[model samples]
Target chain A: DAGVTQSPTHLIKTRGQHVTLRCSPISGHKSVSWYQQVLGQGPQFIFQYYEKEERGRGNFPDRFSARQFPNYSSELNVNALLLGDSALYLCASSLERDTEAFFGQGTRLTVV
Target chain B: SQELEQSPQSLIVQEGKNLTINCTSSKTLYGLYWYKQKYGEGLIFLMMLQKGGEEKSHEKITAKLDEKKQQSSLHITASQPSHAGIYLCGADLGGSSNTGKLIFGQGTTLQVKP
Candidate 1:
């Protein structure tokens, strides 16, 4: 079975621009979450969705938002990106809430 | 705010030696998870422990949850090059955190010298 899959593997955007990262959860998985991992740091939780509903959000600013689809896929959107937003954006999926999560390869975003 | 702290931020051990990394949380952990990652890559799940005093092992890697449920340790025996990576511990914030939000530690980087 395929694990969580992310799109574009790598991207480059300028400050004040917007970027959208996509993730497709594994088959049979119902929960999807997003995390931001800066260099030399651990992944920080962003948003989590289950059954197409927002279940949890982290300390990120309002500029960072995400939503889940009925099909269990997810998209993370960042508006007016800043240089600090440049990092590896990871997507993880689990069988259910509070369960072990499997991660995707992640999308590397670089803002200049 | 909940925080996870890992000890010995970095380690370099001989290939045949053993090493242990610890993860501690400010709050009691409802669930503790171990994951490994290479630089610039996604996390690879290792194991998960929920009950206090619980212990689990996979291959040469072993993980244990403390009785207080606020700490976890990962031990690797006869380490190999393949085990060289950043080990991270994540804690589940139970109660209002029904979404399975995991707070991760800063991570411990392990390097095995052959």
Candidate 2:
């Protein structure tokens, strides 16, 4: 079975610009969550969606937003990108809560 | 706030040696998960411990959840080059977080020398 997949393996943008990262969850997976992983640190939770609904959100600023598609795919949008927003944006999918999660290769964003 | 904290932010061990990584959470977690990631790659789930005092093993890796359910440990037996990576511990606060919104620790990077 194919695992989670992400688009635009790498991206570059200037400050104050906007970017969108896409994610396709594993087959039959109903949950999709987004995380931001800066260098030398762990991934920070951003948003989580289940059954096409916004289930939870993290402590990110209003610049970060996300949505889930009917097919369980997800998109993470970052507005007014800052250099600090440059990190590996990871998308993880799980069958359900407390279940093992599969991750995508992630979108590496670089803000100049 | 960061609810989970990991120890030994980084470690170096010789090949065939054993090492253990610890993770502690400010709040009791409903589920604790261990994941490993190679530089520039995605994370791979190692194990998940839900109930307190639970233990599980996979190949050379073993994990245990403390009875208090606020702490967990990952022990790698006979560490190898393949085990050289960043190990992250994630905790799920049982609440409305059914979407697998896990809170992760800062991570411990293990370097094994041959």
Candidate 3:
């Protein structure tokens, strides 16, 4: 089966702009989570949705939000982006809320 | 302070050598996961350990979760150049109800020389 897939493998945005990243989970998966990885650092949790509902959120600012669809696809949106927002946005999916997750190639976002 | 800490920010070893990487958590870990990532690529899941003192292996890679559940280690026997990548350890500290939100450590980058 195909693994988690993310869209727009890369993106470039300006400060104060908004961007949306998309993710399609593996078939039969019901959980999708978002993470941001800065250069040379590991990923940091952003948001997690299970069965189309928000289950957990990390320490990210209000500018970051995400939602899962009935089909288990997800979108992560960041508003009023700042240069600091530049990073690799990764989407991960699992069979359930707490199971092992597989990640996507990630959307590389660069804000200037 | 970082919730998860990984030792040896980077490693370089000759092929056929054995090396170990560690992940320590300040809080009790509900689940510990190991993943590998090449530059500009997605993470490749290696192993997951939930039970304390649990140990699992795949080929030449072995992962162990300490009895205390707060420490984990990954050992590679007869390392090969294919093992070169960023090794990351992710921890779930939200208990049983966690929804897959993971706190990851600063990855340990490994470089294997042939």
Best by lDDT: 3
* Fnat for the candidates in order: 0.61, 0.69, 0.82
Q: In candidate 3, how many clashes are counted?
A: 0
lDDT of 1 by residue, A17-112 (tens): 999999999998999999999988889999999999998899999999999888999999999999999999999999898678999999999999
Candidate achieving higher DockQ, 2 or 3: 3
Reference-based lDDT, each prediction: 0.91, 0.91, 0.93
Cα-lDDT of candidate 2? 0.91
DockQ values per model = 0.67, 0.68, 0.77
Please provide TM-scores, in order, for all candidate models, with all chains considered together.
0.97, 0.96, 0.98
RMSD of each: 1.4, 1.3, 0.9
Task: Pick the winner on DockQ between candidates 1 and 3.
Answer: 3
Off by over 4 Å in 2: B95-99
TM-score of 2: 0.96
User: Residues B39-111, candidate 1, lDDT per residue (tens digit)?
Assistant: 8899999999988999999999999999999899999999999999999998886644333588899899999
- Assess the local accuracy of residue B17 in candidate 1 as a C-alpha lDDT between 0 and 100: 95
Considering only N, C-alpha and C atoms within 3 Å, which residue pairs clash in candidate 2? none
**Runs of candidate 1 exceeding 4 Å displacement:** B96-99
After best superposition, candidate 3 residue B57: deviation in angstroms? 0.4
